[model samples]
Target: MNDKNDLERLRIQIRGAVQGVGFRPFVYRLATNLGMVGWIKNSAEGVWIEIEGTRSQLDLFLLKLEQEKPVHSLIQQLQASSLVPLDESDFEIYPSVSGEKTTIVLPDLATCSDCIRELFDPNNPRYRYPFINCTHCGPRFSIINALPYDRPNTSMNAFQMCDRCRTEYENPLDRRFHAQPIACPECGPRLEWWDHHGKRLASDEAALQAAIQAIQNGQIIAVKGLGGFHFMVDARNSDAISTLRQRKHRPDKPCAVMYPSLAAVQKDCELSDLEAQLLTASEAPIVLLRRKANISVLERVAPNNAYLGVLLPYTPLHHLLLSALNFPIVATSGNLSNEPICIDEREAIQRLSGIADAFLVHNRPIVRAVDDSIVRVIADREMILRRSRGYAPLPIALSKPVPTCLAVGGHLKNTIALTIDSNLFVSQHIGDLENQATLKAFKQAIDTFEQLYEVHPDLIACDDHPDYLSTQYAQHRSSKFPSSQIFPVQHHHAHIAACMAENGLEETVLGVAWDGTGYGLDGTIWGGEFFLANLTDFQRVGHFKPFRLPGGEKAIREPRRAAIAVLYELWGEAAFDRTDLTPVQAFNAQERDILQAMLQKELNTPWTSSAGRLFDAISALLNLVQISTFEGQAAMALEFALEHISTDEFYPSVIHQGIFDWSTMVEEIIADIEQKTSGAMVSAKFHNTMVEVILQFARQWKQKRVVLSGGCFQNRYFSDRTIARLQAEGFQPYWHRHIPPNDGGIAVGQAIIAASQLLKRGG
Candidate 1:
């Protein structure tokens, strides 16, 4: 009815999270239903579409495009331009074009609801298919090796699709249309069970049955998942869990448990609405929830912890396995302590042979390793404890644009980040860089990020710690990329910058960066610090009083040594004669004399203002934990020891010349111990004292915006109370949500600070 002159053409370019999310097929269906002639194709930049129709039709298409986008698709930027109409009869999906990559790679999603329904339906052709996936779900970053996100670029390229799957993929009306990982049991990758000795046991359905039986038999099974392998064992089998702990060399650190259903989770642990929502969300992460009373089966699983990390099964295979068992299972990372998770089958078998009794693996190769993410609710908001699996390679939007850079994170809880335009891409949790294997994994993660995004950084950022392996790697990389400048960021400053960057704050703010240890610019170990910081720079304002760490790094693993050091600082050499103190009683007279000599001679003793060591000292003084088996054990024990007491009471402390001295509080605690005061009351008073110190500092500062960062903020009780107090005092306090407060998030901070410095230099 309309004249040909009324026809118009529009060429649209869509960027950000558009590919691998059915954007092309969605566009094709929209165009066909509207009776328009056009073509859509995938490009390195994103999706490109050209359509010709009446002006009204084109206008309607554009409106619907924004209104009815796919659930997983995030359209960050869209540009449309007028183009000459080509009189085509039907719409088409062209092959993807290759160029300099600029598109964002979507994180691997949990199985979708539609897929879950199809998985359990008896009549569905893809019933019980572990690889069953549609455009809405399944693997993304884990299986992707190259850009454009086409089938040829994924691990599924090895297995050719059958006729039915091909038909569904080519049909614009089907949900599986353009689904890169779509396949059926007839042609998809199959599961295989193998013994620890590399002998084949079973295949397909029998393989799943074999795994289930092994778990029932109290044997450890290394199961391959979407991101990496996991060591699954019956949670109720205390002996089996103990064996796993001994074998995995993880003695005291808690393991995550995967429950059969939400009902089962609620039965074992208390769950709030927000926690429940996170468990069932697409990015299913292990959430730390307070355990219900008398859950005896989980006693050995979490040990002395007050909370348990629980998650619902996210994959079809997990659902199938859990459905058969109808119970909870310990699903910890499939790697040894302080190492990256195993991704390849051979690698998993090699690394986990001693720990796993059997293997539940498949042919689908995992291109990169991604551990399950861990989170907890703090200040009524979800705070990430570990960022991996469901949440890696996703860019955190920056407030302003800067030059490309790579940030090699701190020594412990290592993670890396790279900047492209205004987006900062933080890598998954790459374990501690202690041994060669972990260091290799760290480098590989950086390489993977660079290859996937095609980013050659113009700047490199690293912690100021000269002895840290991450800093050394940054120096080595600088040698290779001679044109790139290397920037060594101060540790606490980087922590504050990372929190500020994620919150999109560009203005100056008062930053409270407290952790166990960091390399201070003053050539000392600094952790408890206050700073006036922005994204570009920071100035150290106040800090905790310095104390000598006897036996240097040995004091970290042995809290009694820290306690002895504190006593020595307060009472000098005569402090060792206090035989009634728990720390003195824990060590013999000979050992006490040796420690006193070490302190007096300054032999391997380093001056530190570390807040973490202070917590260790307090825990040791309370006789809660003398020798830590894992990182943050003493601090965690301190937090868990709090009883229902008065929140308003706090020990007396004073600040002199910007030094928030803990001497007065320690003296009060000693007096309380002499008076036979309860440990809970003393612990509560100590926590309240720290809060009071923070409040006093906030009152003195003119800045209203307070940014909390570093590992100390991981304590939910501390953070929640701090945020509440700050809010009550008419101050705005911001903490991490998507990123962790530990060293795992320092890379993000490093990247932002490096970028800001480079921009200031007009790079």
Candidate 2:
């Protein structure tokens, strides 16, 4: 040691995601390994580090700290200053700062490999335990009540840790080191069983086994998960599936299946390399895999679809239950139709009383309700259909940080986003906030996100629809915070912005946004639209031709009515003269007369340029679906009917001045019907024509990037073929990756657009 003056004590202030994601333990390990004397503790501001060591050793420690941090941790700032040396003997980690107000919060993590191994290992103490988890895995965001990420700040505070768990939590070498939710079978939450009538069954392992037996016997069981409850039934039982459909009022929307393992999934569907990887990834999202030929799943599970939405068990509870069952289970959300998922046990019993035959209840309370995420493989890349569960609260990295803001999403598939500093926390899927229950859930989620992330928005952003609940909520909040700016973004523009943000594109591009309906700037229903847009600015350059919706909102529920409207637009009065139409035959004489008169008088009819309407028309034309039980049932059935068609020849409607010649398409479709073309062939031809039209537009704007978004892109046939054709033509085509292409992603897009607008205004 040359000089004693060289020895110094330095205090470092570290910030930016330096909490909750094993950052403290990482620091402890690093400091101990560096042979430096330091005491590190987490404060509300950030990690506080005081080190007294030789200058060279401190330099090496700093270098290693930057290079060797935890995989998920982000160190944004590291401030170091010299202090008087105390000559501490060893490095130690102090308890987290008490009662501190911290801005940083951690996301909930999927179960880690180490925990998974323990769950499966026969020799491990936690073998096959339904509640086994450690620091790197299990619940964080959902159980959390306040910041600093300690057990007392979570729902887990009610359960005192046993001595063994406390010892393991204190040991840095143990996987449970500092795990707030650490628990064992003896000390953690236990499962209980209940009948449909809210009467408690036997509270033992036999109860769980009996619950599994009931599911195998084709009974619907409501099982509580980490975030919410799920209704489970045997996948092979058609009667049970139909019963669930009728009870949930979800007749045609595909229900996801939970398989026991990946090996089981391989038997039912053809999984690609990426599909398999995504299935095995920590975020075990439901992967829409191509189904095997003649696989005998209940027809009601994926009515009229070639692919099945499948997911492997993500949680220990699911694993244990599925293993006991030894078969695929139809695991759909436990809720009434169009309602938010039930999280509280009392609420679940009250709401799902008539839907499920039994209940697999748990003692642990779920502070948040998160639905299972759904995804599909398009062009060899994973595309999110729904973003929830393992994905939410994990902030999507922005190209550039923005000021604090809150984004209230669209009327349907609603979710809210809050941006604080550099992190943006999105709420879980909030369903349609059109009803009282969903609206209440939306408000609760918003409050929870703000409290957890410690953010108060300086600006509020919402969809342009004045009547939407989300918009009204934003308006109310803005009125309360009079100084905060409020901005309304066009719905389709938000769709394109979401796509652009996901792909990290900055330049202007061609955006094709298609969906069911959105309140257009011109006050007409806009769905099929083409826009020239970037982050802030968007111009509508193209759209589908407008036609009268015979009964307005009634037409959406009845596809045959939309078909009659299309027929009237195409063949005029001669449409009723056709004797071969089954839809016409299905209508009684009085009903037919009323329909014709309504079309002629245009009573309560609204004009729409919606691609979703075209799908309804095709569905009714094929006689495949006359009345849609769900929102997009007719379109989904139409897509299913197209599975038999070849992609050899494409006949697309001409585009003039950026508008699709839908009148000509309708005439061509009528001609095909007159020629006695099979419904299957016509459906295939219609799908191919749409793909051709999209490709044509991409070729026209070859210089600009092509972004595919909106709920319509959820149709795999159109999205897959369109992407392939565009890539073949040597044009760059981008689709959604992390966020959903549907309205679920609209909140993030709204936030980005709002931030850009604020920057433009120099706010």
Candidate 3:
């Protein structure tokens, strides 16, 4: 009570996810209630608070601060120091400091329950509001242009709140208080429709209804969403799904579905508890749910797979659109084959003109493009396939902080990572950067992440592939930071490192990295590799035997060539004369002759140790797939066929020099085909043989831990069975949890490895 005579002041610095997630508002409320006089502001460093009050009040304020932080905010540091008292009357919230470099950026969040309730409430002013949002929901990472997230720094700056919203913004009791994206029906963006010819429709609602009707009548429509655009069609309409498949040039890859609600998703597929939780999480990623047998959805949507990727509406516009459309819709990316998604309206019309019958779009600009996030529930935990939308810009916390660094990811499924101070932020999916548009998108995304996080990286890291566009970009950026070192990490090593980082492993583990292709350290293509790796160093222990990649990358698009190579290695010229072989019409005479010559002379052919190529070889050997329209179509088809086979007995195989004699597996396949063994039986035997061989390898090492990585892990049948079998043997098996098991997570591994190297050097 005698504080007036002997006043004490305190300055506090709070860091770690204390910005752009209602941290300031919580502070304001706490300070006001505690009868403390101080001002809180957001700086480039973190949240800054100065309090001048009685020691007891200050103690109470600090006590409540940590215990009562905002639901999503994580307070990593809270330091307080006494200072001279500044006699102030009331506490206040100050404007954020600008031009201060930092590494903090917010993650995009799914629509909150309150926003959903308000969207459907007929009496609410924001009823049917396409952009209804508050501090707890809506765009954060995607829309932000700068840090210290304020309205003016986002795309929301264009829309001014009405008087009522302004009152709510000033009222601490209101949920919308200081909400940056606060908008109403009158002030926010609205949906509009356009025909395939780019002509504007007369009525937005009527045009959308007409589009829905067309989808019901077997036509495809391109629908714009918060991040980018999606090409949607009726999931149950086989003709519509087939038409979309043909138009998008996607022959075998599965398309995701946008169900009307959670209940609707449950009606079509069986959901585990974890699947249900992830489906309803704030991220709202598309969850791969196992389909109930004999479901009525069109076969073209997922082909032979037992699971379907399903998602609930994450945006207000999506909710409204789905509420009017009664059936599930095939929601896929709106783009041409092998291209990035179209974000601009003009780009959408120009790029998607041939595929979409109509376009449902909006006027709000997407400052940065983001793809929809994809996930699957494995072993009762969420495994991300494509981490974007609600997941991007959210820094993955590291066990140890490192100097600022940037990691340029691989050529395919490109994504970049930036680390400043202790936090690391990974960009959204940038697609394959082989094309100009995707490369431009990659550059833009990098610039966006750097700007928003205020990061000026002191070092740059890239893949060892000299031909990769990501490598070129890193080289170009290196000039700007002359003092910054550029570290080139091998692609497969990065893959193992990524898994190690996600699991927080400190010791060496045997990493089995399997994929399609990566430039190996030995100047060959390496995909099936076994390495004893930690964050700092790795030693190659074993790998698949090398086979000539006939015609290089061309062999990947045509599985028959891979078949010829595998057969040639096993049976020479007699490989083609095998009576069980079926001549597929897809490979013309000239193509066959060239492949034969290439295999014989090994002309212009590079060798690769790739498990994906082995899968391709099996697909062609069985005449299951002659051509692959997507990257992993042949492999997926093979997995599907394998699912039908029974695993009652193990197929015989020989292991020589740590390499499983795959020739024996091929011989067994040929023998099975000649004997007219059931396709299911052959497939089951094949899957079992591969699993047995991998287990045998593990047995040889007796390694306590196994790290499974690479794009191949996306296969649920293989990953699940492998992990289960290994766990039964009392070994701890680790897979990517926070990020993808594919190349999308390579940057994470690169960062972890680079940080470890730097720490060792410093020590």
Q: Which stretches of candidate 1 lie over 4 Å from their true place?
A: 643-646
TM-score of every model versus the real structure: 0.98, 0.93, 0.93
Per-residue lDDT of model 1, residues 669-706, tens digit only:
99998999988889988988898888888888868999
lDDT (Cα atoms) of all candidates against the true structure: 0.90, 0.82, 0.81
RMSD of each: 1.4, 2.8, 2.7
Best by TM-score: 1
lDDT score, candidate 1: 0.90
Candidate 3 per-residue lDDT over residues 1-763, each given as its tens digit: 3458666799998877777678888988888887778899887667899988787888888889889988778887688898888788888888788655563666777888999899899999988777888878787776778777778888888888788888877776678777777777666676777898888884445655766677777778888778888998888888888888888888888899989888888878998888988888888899988888766677789886777989988888778778888778999988887788888888899999899988888777778888889998766578898988878867777776777778989988888888766667788988887789888898898788677765667677889999999988888878776877888888988999888777778689988999998889999999888888888889888788788877899888888778877877876766655544753345666766776787788797888889888888888877888677778888877877865455745577677777666877788887888899877777777777766767877888888899999988887777878788889898889998778888899887777677678887992
By lDDT rank, best first, the candidates go: 1, 2, 3
What is the Cα-based lDDT of residue 258 in candidate 2? 88
TM-score, candidate 1, is: 0.98
Candidate 3 has an lDDT of 0.81
Candidate number with the higher TM-score (2 or 3): 3
In candidate 2, how many clashes are counted?
A: 0
